[model samples]
Target: MNSPTAPRRDDRPQDDRTAHRTILLRGGDVHSPADPFATAMVVERGQVAWVGSEGAADAFADGVEEVVDLQGALVTPAFTDAHVHTTSTGLTLTGLDLTGARTREEAIAEVRAHAAAHPADPVLLGHGWDAARWPDDRPPTRAELDGATGGRPLYLSRVDVHSAVVTTALLDLVPGVADRPGYAPDAPLTRDAHHAVRAAAYAAVTPEQRTRAQRAALRHAVSLGIGSVHECAGPEISGEDDFTALLRLAREEPGPRVVGYWAEQVAGARDAEKIRALGAVGAAGDLFVDGALGSHTACLHEPYADRDHTGTAYLDAAAVASHVAACTEAGLQAGFHAIGDAAVTAVVDGVRAAAEKTGLARVRAARHRVEHAEMLTPETIAAFAELGLTASVQPAFDALWGGDDGMYAQRLGTERARTLNPYAALLRTGVPLAFGSDSPVTPLDPWGTVRAAAFHRTPAHRVSVRAGFTAHTRGGWRAVGRDDAGVLVPGAPADYAVWRTDSLVVQAPDDRVARWSTDPRSGTPGLPDLTPGADLPVCLRTVVDGRTVFVRPDE
Candidate 1:
């Protein structure tokens, strides 16, 4: 495990012991999330010196020069998103975002608008359009997309990032895509097909534009009180040089800390030497066991209900086993993206065999993780506990896709649907859970993610507010092996969130918990009262690490 790189823009002196500034946060109901709620906290030189009642502030008062009266607002540890595509998220912020398009027509309209605004001569590029929720349920074809932009070579990605819909003009630009075996058969461009278009589009982004996008995304994360993000950009999406540059810039700028993970296409190429090199460079490598559920390619044990095929396995079993073994030998932790039951089982077995071969005690310390264990059987769930694996999940997916009439039932039928997104069940079975926003796929809002996990559509799957909060904070810190982050104890970093609400703990009646409150306008359900007898109105005032990085307008 490695500590996150500091933002490059920090001008403050790094001398922690003899810093002149001392700030006291008084009268806030500090919910460490890792610990029970406390009355106040004191921060000195970017570390927590005291966290208790207001009376404990006197210990640090000798050199204190500033005091923040929270007026009894709620405070919690700063959030750490365990998995996200940082630079991609930043690009989406600065580029065309069609996340809200509900139909082919709407998606086309968005692309047309973007093309009009940017007016690029060669290709029009945009991302974040999901056809899974569209009225037709069919992705817009090349013909339809061509018609939309008048053959402007438009390319748009689905929300899952597993697939993309490109117009004929764009298809013509790719050298051998039309003759690619899986291109037309898969219908929607996914996996290798998506990779080709994404490469072409991403290449169009200049260094200056990419940097601006990264900064914009970083500022947004700061605004949302997210202190750290594990940037999961695979080699296909971003080259090693791009990742190195991004990491260096992040360390040199005033922004969120970054943990980079490389995505490798060939597992055998990931040997001990490669792993050590990545470790020296402060980056991790990830593999894809399968594609995504939206594309019906999440390698399932059984065939999809509506389709004759079981999902595709991106990596063969042998490759997975070898990758795991190599990672273990190289002192590197490997992560696999496994969203379906079949994928989960294969990854689990592969990891187990590798660990057994290498000795479990040795591999356990590496903390290999499984990203998006969205669909798991009881046996696979148990395997996670036995292998000491971590589950990196996105709660917002459940919030948008967990209703009875959702995609799970529509795509997999009723029986298979029962196994979707069992977060609580995984926790019960002793799997270490780390939460993330998976931004560009989902909005990067930690508070909203907590709310989604706490109010899962399936009652049994719902997690307690405290557990959800901890997943985003402490568990995330643990995932990356930064023990001091996501806590308010003395000697820990001074990263923390101040909420307008009293507590994240839900106290609503059981019946009312599932139903949206009478006020449909209320964005969050079961929120604690900010003002007694009134609705909770939580807002981040400042996200501070000894010094404030973001301050709300009112503050």
Candidate 2:
């Protein structure tokens, strides 16, 4: 598939240092997840200096500084979500969204029009709110949010932040949460009483409203072509000054490229210097050994085929072997959030007993990770390929909860809900997958997460579309160690995505080859429209990092 005129080879570095501005791009159709199709790259000052064809643009026409051409469309790369929360998807894009509220009286008329246009108070907070497509499947009480917020103190949330639906003046401001322990005398609020009213409305917002809800969730992940994000952030309910105020407001804004991950819980990983100042800013995020399979509290090794429960293991194996030996002796690269199968065999026996009490080549050179090894068990996917770890998944939660009347066959009934999120049985047991959109609990669309890991609505968990676009580009930059951020060629990182088809590399038998070219008003159904398509028409005219940050509306 390398034809624009094929004859390329520029593998970078030949420096006499001064020929930098190149772009070129030429007659498009490049895919390069290390080739699944398309071809013709080039770039330069941002990296990827020359991929082939279109007669390799006359060998970069004496160091061309701009070419672009692309009369073919469909390039790739620029998509790396790998788990997100980026200031709760930028505070669910400035709150009161109610995602696609089908009912609970249309999510209480969108929280009574955002508590009557923000009537100053400690209570009007709102969030996603899907009482499983309510029609009385129940969830809006607290006397129906105190008769549509008139008594103020409302709360909302519940598109799986594991529950929250407060009111009654936020249950009289959290007093004895109707007898706690994930409260539910007929679900008064919910799960740990809506995780204490969503940790007191995310600790009473402000820090300039959490930097304007994380720059409106990094401008909706750079108008949906993503780039990078792993934020995660929970530390007993977000702190470390909310991930150093979202990495100092994403290093003084110009969005996307976050990678934070410090949701510790499980007794805050026995604070070994706050897990080495959250692995001193570079091993890129993780921590959590259970909870989430829509809060049945994932930690299963049998016992959730219609609940008599057998989950919930948030650390206990000598506190996840002393927080994976204090995050692998402080150089940090540990992750955990295992989605049951006894929390992926208690985090693969706590990272194989913290790599045999420290020293499996210093925990495989600190590349450790697990986060949602969903419900694996081919001996925990061959112990995640004999402990090189890193799974960090979320194939759009198996295309919106792998259907056939979803929610894992009504809560784990169909043979342990046919092991969700296997990603082709963890890449045929060599295990090392990565792709995420846990964003405000899913909807960040890396091409609808590579079409739900390539149409894997359970056909034994599909996977292919060049293994879901190299698990969302270079296995999410080698799960955050970032070897030059996802690929393109020459020297990487000129971050990509051009596609209005070539369909993320010829795997389109359905999802009409990565859909979207229209439809996005948050109807929230398989998002794609970063608008461009009209017969080979993808857009992003200039998302260049050496200069242009998102440009397409005809450039």
Candidate 3:
């Protein structure tokens, strides 16, 4: 171990730009992400006034109204979940949860119990039922669900929102479902059938219930130190009224900010303008060029190891190129959901063609992105780097469905499964990567997501703690087309979180030593000690724009 080092002293807080009021946070190790050693910060007029040592707090405290002692806790930028399904996630949080039901019988019993508990309800809505881990590897049949619910309407979504199991009641409301694609009597509905059933289910939700659900999900986000989220909405995924209502609620209420995306494929600039009219950031999001790996809807170049089908690809190179060109011409970001290699290739080819037709600079400036670019080839990685595409990825996907014997392996086989979600290669290729939970599919566990990326299943694919944290924080800001914020630097937005942690030390690139600790004499510091089984930091306070969005009672 090395000796402790003296802390850094950057430029003192410039009082010229200071607001009439100021806040001084003192006595803690701050992982500014940009600055290696920042113990304290001064917040002035909704921005960071100064970031330096605790000793220099007196210099910036002349006009300070408040001085918060972090008491040796960790302070970092607030997190942003770049992708989410607000209403659906909230429903899961507040409603019936069958995600834990292990067997077919247990799943049906839970549904019966929930319907019994909420007998006054006209419809039963629940999500998360995975049969992969079950010994029988099957969900309860419609007949069984019908018996359990006693003829009530039921809509249970599979773990991935790509599929759902609708009771006969819902099936009745959604006519022509059996004739539609992806309809199955015993299995969950997918594609067209799932869409129709989902729409009918949403129709059953009252406006009051919808508003309550949205509010619940936003409150949960801020409580966990999340400052903002990009709601991935679409016509096929969610109704316009719901998306607009969410945007309105976010503005009217004091909660985590919601950035909206329409997630529907648009052809012309006129259509893109219509999306903008709906208050969407762009006509992009879960604009599914493909689907998810779990549901086996992700379009692959090769057939699945378990099944003979190679999965579905909704868009070809020309279609992708057309969308990108239109979005670029309209000066909007273009994003698509692509999980498998074939889908990824089509997206890249489309981007490349659009770049050639328009300009590379135009495409790059548009900040085009692809969600769940999981199964990428080296060529696709290089293309993303060349085009400056943002990858809105979910690390929890790998954590929940990856590894040698996990769902990925079960779907694709061990050899191909281990290669899924190669984050290291993307970052190394200079492709800007933004980490998100893709909630409703995964819970909003930011720390767990970071740990999963840092401790990836394949050692060769794993990123360091610093890299993972950066992708989650700063990278998220970049995804939203901001060159600022998501860092504890002077003049940045005062959006940050205080965490109850064991010790505050950043990770250094030094590998010569076996152990990692601060060296005050050498001025060396490190990131959090986020090794395996380490306790993830608990949020004590979360501040957005210098306002207290969430706070724990002083202990």
lDDT of the candidates, in the order given: 0.72, 0.65, 0.83
Clashing pairs in 1: 8-251, 8-252, 8-253, 9-252, 9-253, 9-254, 234-263
**Tens digit of per-residue lDDT, candidate 1, span 152-271:** 777687788878888887777789986653487436787777788778777766787778777888788878888777888666667655676677776666556676676663244444
TM-score of 3: 0.94
Q: What is the TM-score of each candidate against the true structure?
A: 0.88, 0.34, 0.94
Q: Name the 10 consecutive residues with the lowest summed lDDT in model 1.
A: 3-12
Residue-wise lDDT of candidate 2 within 62-86, one digit each (tens)?
7775777767776666777878777
**Cα misplacement distance, residue 552 of candidate 1 (Å):** 1.8
lDDT score at residue 366, model 2, on the 0-100 scale: 64
How far residue 435's Cα lies from its native spot in candidate 2, in Å, is 3.5
Question: Which candidate achieves the best lDDT against the true structure?
Answer: 3
Q: What's the C-alpha lDDT at position 331 in model 3?
A: 75
Kindly give the stretch of ten consecutive residues in candidate 3 with the minimal lDDT sum.
1-10
Instruction: Give candidate 1's TM-score.
Output: 0.88
Ranking of predictions according to TM-score? 3, 1, 2
